[model samples]
Target chain A: MSTERGLFDLTCADFGLIRGITESWDHLLSRSIAAVREQFIEQCGLIAQAEALPRIAGRILGLMVFDGKDYSFSEIAEELQISRGSVSSSVSLLTAMGVIERTAKPGDRQDYFRLSEDPYTTFFARARNRAERAHKTIQETRDAVPKDKREIRSRLKEYETFYATLIKALDSGT
Target chain B: MSTERGLFDLTCADFGLIRGITESWDHLLSRSIAAVREQFIEQCGLIAQAEALPRIAGRILGLMVFDGKDYSFSEIAEELQISRGSVSSSVSLLTAMGVIERTAKPGDRQDYFRLSEDPYTTFFARARNRAERAHKTIQETRDAVPKDKREIRSRLKEYETFYATLIKALDSGT
Candidate 1:
């Protein structure tokens, strides 16, 4: 009976050891995931800055894209470690640009936000619109030039062509 | 003989009056040209700022595109009314981007510059390159995720698609 009891105790001990190891492994995996999330968010901010956008806006986008979940205004601020004011402004800007949309959750009074259904298309469309406006401006400038000045008129034509091509490319892509 | 001499003097006076009128008209026309050039350059600067590029760089491009003539470094500085140092840096940036090229004028040591051959294509190509790099980054981020994280992976895939479409459109247009 004594021998049997000892064997049982040893088995329990081994199980405890195994459980501890498994728990630690789970903890490490979660930590690694968190680290990757942080790094990815930072990278998004950097990329946005490279494109001359506000880094905070990019980070907000990163969180939405990576987590694949909606976040409340305060949640975004807390997750990004930014001020609520900045969050308000950035959220407004993103919404205005049609890159993100607001949502309502059951039993929640505050608004939540998520990436729009087709933000990429909206973004490209905006780019195309800007290019069209630029093309119009160039055309007007060209028209203002006297017809006798062939050289200047031709040069302006090149600018018009550049904007036209850009707009067409954006239109087709979107 | 006296009457004939008086008539000859009157004719000379009329010629002087007509020459003065022509000179003033030329002055006004040149001023209008200068104003249009200034407005165009300013527009270029604004457009550059919109794209997150330096205004001076855009102005330089505007000058080159509008004038359709090569300009010396000092001439660019003088014409734009910017500091020589600014012109130097902006010129370097433009050259590096392949939008402008330097040339040597015979019997003159100073370097002259003009728009690159097909600068529009080069500009679009650079944009496409940026989109490709962004797509690659998104792909790398997606790969880092474990296979089980299907949702995150799919979100990143959308980003990849956006860049791919943009690149393809740019390629087709250019």
Candidate 2:
């Protein structure tokens, strides 16, 4: 009977801790949101860098994707603590790439930016195009090389095959 | 008959152009390979930057992936035009991360480095681990917040769902 009472007290203490954490969750996140935001920025920065663009473009995309809401240029700049000019250029680049879309509010001249419905699909589509181009380049190089150079022929053929397979996989969406 | 002759002439011209290009393909790539190499380096550099690692590590991996062959430290330095020390440090980091592997020649003391057979698989595996960690963080944050704040609750829930779905996708390898 004493052991059962002790166990009940422990369970109640655990519940109290849970209740305290649940009540203050927002306060905790608000205090630590900077770290989370930085991590997302880094993730997007990587994607942007791989695509051979400025980090700012990735940061803007990351912000838009995470917020899951549209933001005007001024709003984005203010939220991200960046300059309006930087936001303008990055937003323009992302718009041209079709990674983000531009919309406007009724009776408002401000342009708002948001991520596309399926950004990953669009992202991989661009990658597939790049792979296709590289594959074509390798094929051309293979054709141009002398038939006698078997080693070079074999190496180029391998590259050609890799790119071909990459494009096929991307096209298949698997 | 005249139209047939004109078509034949056009085909012959095209073949002639192909022959010329074929003969010069090796020469062309040799000159342009630098640009191509830089592109790979840039791509890898982005990945490294996002991961908060040195750019050299990505450059080494990029070179190995593109070359599709094992290379000695000196050869890597020579090909990528980086310092020997940079190669040593970056190669170590990549090796530790399992992104690159170290091999050896039977009669040679020098260590050779090459990319893993399926680098993308391995790369995404690491990313999935990071995502799982982030998901846990988000879950904890959500648990700590008050339930009465609908806007904050919805936003946190959205982020939690995104990370949860991401981890699941990565786990399923689809």
Each model's iRMS = 3.3, 6.8
What is the TM-score of candidate 2? 0.56
- Tens digit per residue, CA lDDT, model 1, A18-113: 999987876445446677788889888887776667898889888989998989989998899999999998898888888899999999998899
Estimate TM-scores for all models.
0.81, 0.56
Which window of ten consecutive residues has the lowest lDDT sum in model 1 chain B?
B1-10
Could you give the CAPRI-style class of model 2? incorrect
Best lDDT goes to which candidate? Answer: 1
Residue pairs with backbone overlap in model 1:
none
Judging by DockQ against the true structure, name the best candidate.
1
Error of 1 at A6 (Å): 44
User: For model 2, how does the per-residue alpha-carbon lDDT over B21-131 read when each residue is reduced to its tens digit?
Assistant: 976874565535555556645666655665556888867766775566889989998987889999888988888777788999899999998876555455446646765
